[model samples]
Structure formats: structure tokens, C-alpha cells
Target: MSTLTDRLIYIVGPLKLQNALMASFLERETGAKCLAVEKFHDIQNMDNENTGQPKLALWDCLGNDMESCLSEFEPDFKEVLNHSAVAFFNVSPDLGIEAEFIARGVQGFFYEHDRIERFPQGICAIFNGELWFSRKIMNEAMKKDKKQTGLQTRYETDLSHREIEILAMIAGGASNKMIAEKLYISPHTVKTHLYNIFKKINVTNRLQAALWAAKNLS
Candidate 1:
């Protein structure tokens, strides 16, 4: 698999020195070339026609008005989402922008106070085509999913007790490995149970299953 350093990275924010330092650190840590731009318009003016590789954009939201910054960059955000992936750094837990960004296809989010050492791991996960949100954000998403699916009753769906237990864990933002460990089951067994759970509940992904659990199990 290609590492994150193999791709171009753009750090978007208003702080020039801080952004430059961040870019330097990322390059030193990952051996990846990075560009620090103060405005989205700078990115728009760059020539990227030669490299067809998907780029990564990290929006630094520390010490600024999150809502105002996001609103100002909404057009640029959409443009970046068209051909590349976007992630947020220095985010607050209660910023309440996760859902909107998720809806806009954001790939990752890191809390403002999170350790900088985890940046490489998060970036790698995003490069590997996975969502890298904080556990709090995931739990909030689960709650939202659950509330949206709350009209359905348990009696309406004949899910087994084990299935319900697993679904509840899923809604709580537990990974398959975590669930398997907690439930004293093999990962394979968890997968099987999830498949059955999805089929029974007529849902496809973890988000949907979480919603189903919220509606019926809660």
C-alpha cells in the first residue's frame, strides 16, 4: 500500500508560520512534500493537472471561529471533495460540525487537543479509505442515527438477543474487534452475527445497524 507521504498534502489555514511548521514536521516525519496555504484561493490557483493522484487537504481549525472559517471555505471545501479527500485538525468535540462534514464526505477529524503524534496514523487511515473520527464524534453520529430510526419497534423485527447485544455495541461506537473481545467471540463469529443482523434488520452498514439498534434496543 502506498503511504500517505507518497501523495501531495495541502495544509489549509490562516496562520502562515504555524502552517509552515506543521508542513515541515509532516515532511520530516513522513518524508512527504507538503504545502501550507493561507487561503483556499491559493489552492484554486495552483496547477494540478499533471498529477492525477488524489491529494489530501487538512483544515486546521485551532484558535479560530470554526463556523466562520467553514462558511468562508464552503466553496473550496466542496471543490476539494470533488477530487480529493479532506480532513480536519484541531477540532473541538462540541463543535457540532462533524455531521455536516460527514454529509459532505469528510474522511477524518482530529480533536484540537489530540496528540500530534497521532497525525500520521490518522492520515494513513484516511489514505487507506477509512473514516478516522474521534470516538465522541462516532458516538454522536450513532445517537443521531438512532434517533432517526426510532419509529420502528422491536416487535416489528425478529432480531435475536445476541444480535441485539452486538447491535447495541455497534451503536456505542465499538469496532468489530472490540465487540468480539467484549462478547467473548471470534472476529469471524462477530462478522457472521453482523451479517445476520443486517439481513434481519434490512440495513446494510454499521450506521444503519446502529440506527436500528437505537430505535428498537433503546
Candidate 2:
């Protein structure tokens, strides 16, 4: 396995708003176990003397009083950021405000006003090594160059048809080879598809993915 797969991800911000949402989403949505610290210094201090470091640190970029927070946090911020892939969340509009955070240290910025649907999409994108910007902002950036795009419906990105079938087979006690034969594909293909399905549904194993499919999709 790669070091990234073994590494944890940390989220730092206020307890109630920015940090909690990301912490909950990461724990449930990704394979990594995430640790959340309220302060940047606490996270840096913990990592310095620890056995290993987190894969990434997602900081709430623009907090109460940006100038004051930056002046107070510059030192610890640089240290924590140096260890992990740093991402920022603005949560409010005003691209200028988000830009300021990006300039400070964040590699990516997520809008706070996006529907909860986009939050996971953004995190997953960042986890895979890409920047997640507000499609709203993107729309503005590309407006003159592009044509109209259809708005994505809520259920559109949920699951694939084959994934649903595999999940059902899993719930029905079908082994990988059995699923392979049933689907007229090789066992290797079945395993690969299963892994992708698990990633989509945010589960690590067949049973959990199956249960989620049964309860939510079926």
C-alpha cells in the first residue's frame, strides 16, 4: 500500500461549523481515519513528536477577523502546512475573500454555501489530488467560452447500475467468483469493479456496501 493510504487526514477550524462537517464527512466517506483539532498549533505540536504525520490538513481559511487570525497564526500555520496537503474552506461567497486564503497557504478552496452534496465531491476531489472550486465560480470563469450545461440532479451521481447489481449479489451471499460468472466477466474484473463500487458508496467491504445499497438505493 502507498504511504498516503496509511496516513490520516486532519481538519482544523471551529468546533461547531467548518471543521465538524468535514470531519464527519471524511470519516464516513473516505478510507482514512481523520483527527480534528480546534487550533492549528495543537495539530502542529501533536505531529512533531508523533510516530507519523497526517496525509493532509484542511484549514478553515477565512475565519473571524482574517487579518488578526493570520497575524496570530502565521507561524504554526506554516509548520502544519509544510507537513500535509493544505486545503481551505471559505464557506461564504466573495471570491476575493477565498482568494486571500489561497494566497496564504491553501492549495484548494471550497465554498461554504454549496449544497451538502458538493462537500463530499470536493473532498473526494482533493483526496485524489485536484482542486475543488465552486462550480458557481467556475461557471463565471468559463462563461464566455462554454455553452449551457445541465444542472446535476441530486440522484445523478449516486451509484452505477452495475454497482447496484453487485451490491445486491453481495447481500444475497454471492462470492466474487460467483458474481464474475453471473456478470459474464472475470473474477479480477469483479474485484476491481467492487472496489470502485465501495469507493462510490463509501464502504470498505462487500457487506457494508451491500447494506448501504439495500437501505438507500434499493
Across 44-108, the per-residue lDDT of candidate 1 in tens digits comes to 66636526665778888776565785675586776666566778888887677786565456768
Residue 126, candidate 2: alpha-carbon lDDT: 53
Clashes of each: 0, 1
Give the Cα error of residue 20 in candidate 2, in Å: 4.4
Question: Following a full C-alpha superposition, what root-mean-square deviation does model 1 have from the true structure?
Answer: 5.8
Q: What is the TM-score of each candidate against the true structure?
A: 0.63, 0.51
The pairs that clash in candidate 1 are none
lDDT of 2 by residue, 1-218 (tens): 11234557777776656566666666666656677887778776668655464466766655545566466458687677557667666555643544444334454566666565565565655554344554343333333222232332333346678877877776555667678899999988887888788788676444345435444543
Give the range of the ten consecutive residues with the poorest summed lDDT in model 1.
Answer: 146-155
Candidate 2 lDDT score at position 35: 78
